[model samples]
Target: MSGTALQQVELVVRTIAQTAVDNEKYFGDLDAVVGDGDFGYSLARGFEKVLEGWDDIDRTDVGAFLKKIGMIVTSRIGGTSGPIWGTAFMKAGISAGPANELSGEQVVAMLRAATDGIKARGQSDVGDKTLLDALVPMTDAIERELASGADHAAVLAVAATTARTAAEATSELVARRGRASYTGERSRGSVDAGAMGVAVIVERISHAWTTEGAS
Candidate 1:
């Protein structure tokens, strides 16, 4: 039952798409508490397009699929999330290229590119109470795991745990950037909406990748 990397990527896409759809209301609710209530809907629409365009996406190579997905997200989705997320995926796609299969090192490289891209686009650091709060540490953990010669699943596991921890830690920090910044003290004790979404995607993708590798 072992699936290829492409299969893993596809499963991740589908799982993220499903999660975005199911939790759209939750994100909107979170956003409404502090910022604009658009993150959930915007993410849902972006991932929905990814799912609906799967037929065309399936025919493309991995890098091409990722690139197309990024473009689709940027063009179809609204709000700051669209550009930031699109930049992350596009950077990953560039790093991944059109390889038929990716080594663990390549996976690590892609993750690093994604993190750097998010930082570059958002100009925020790990404590910004944004998605970077999850992504930055996760990518660092992933690189460390891979450098230790861990398997892809192992690296992903480390990344997932790091992301979850970072996402949770966002609750304690004041929002230093984005719409949440205006809330100041009010933003404390609540997870950033975008960071929560990143955690969800990271956890799901880690589970899928590990299960696929084991199978």
Candidate 2:
């Protein structure tokens, strides 16, 4: 898949929701390992609403669809992750606007926007062992690949790898934000559930584009 290739927003939404659904228990357990067990359930509730609105979303209009998903998720899910992830989506949607086909630059811009939104909403950074940890590396990889003129497949490949690496790196650091932060140094040796979840989302997006033959 080339970065120049087109992808439908509906497909992306479906993939994200499905991934969260499949990993519901996993997320709960991860959070339960260190903090509240509601993260997964809250995320699932939000994604369920997004799934319901899937068919109605404007597939070709990336921005509108993303914005709608963000709003739906934020309203349905009752937790911190909901608003944070939703804001990220909303920011990405605003950045991409109504583009029917996204170029590499557009994709990079969306990722950057999403990261910024998450930061503003969460007040967390990479070393804090939050979603930003995964996202920062993923976006940097995407930007590097985009600058080198890599195709969608290549860009996505780098993103998945970088996200995974960042997610793993979270375990070595003590939590500095959110519920887990309350645990202080006890948060060490535990992977950040939010970081893992974000990694899954990014990896799945990459998989969807490649499997669907976006190139």
Candidate 3:
């Protein structure tokens, strides 16, 4: 079970990295609507570092692997992207502790930890028109699905859809955080790039899970 869990984690993380790298231009375009247009580039660079050091990351446990990735991201990436994303991973790692196996509840706990960390690091929350707007609702959907006895596949599916809907809804919100917030009311009518990035990454993870993680 622990070995399978590790494999699943690796698959999910790898998918996230690939999605960030592949959609760099799309993400940048989204951010350019009201931001400095560096969100995608910054994210890609951080995840690229994760991929580059994948083989070298300490896998003593899930916590170590996630924490190591967090450190790499924090150190390698620049601007706001580094701190926001890195804090998420680090907090999740803290919740995961030294466990090699993660139960469904543990996964939720890790996600909550990550979300809280992001809120703290960015000083934002749901309705802030930040990634938290999408992330919070997606996490809620995931928790509800899991509580109903859904499996990973079901949770991933729900989360992906929820994230997309939530991200798209951000177009109606005025940005309250990040560089987009600097534009004030002008930030309306544009989706939050980080939220959309989460949607894309979760969608890819869901697809990858269905195709390659049924074991």
Clashes of each: 1, 2, 0
- Full-model lDDT for every candidate: 0.81, 0.83, 0.89
Worst 10 residues of 1 by lDDT: 206-215
lDDT, candidate 3, 125-194, per-residue tens: 8998999988899999988999999877888899999999999999999998899999999999989999
Clashing pairs in 1: 2-215
Please identify model 3 stretches exceeding 4 Å from their true place: 1-3
- How would you encode candidate 1's per-residue C-alpha lDDT over 71-179 as one tens digit per residue? 8888778888889889887888888888768887887788788878888888987888898888778878877887898776777778788888888888898898888
Alpha-carbon shift of residue 8 in model 3 (angstroms): 1.5
Off by over 4 Å in 2: 1-6, 58-60
Deviation (Å) of 191 in candidate 1:
1.1
Positional deviation of 198 in candidate 1, in angstroms?
A: 1.2
> Tens digit of lDDT per residue, candidate 2, span 166-188?
99889999999999999989999
lDDT minimum window of 10 residues, candidate 2: 1-10
Candidate 3: give the clashing pairs. none
Error of 2 at 212 (Å): 2.3
**Candidate 1 to native Cα RMSD, angstroms:** 2.1
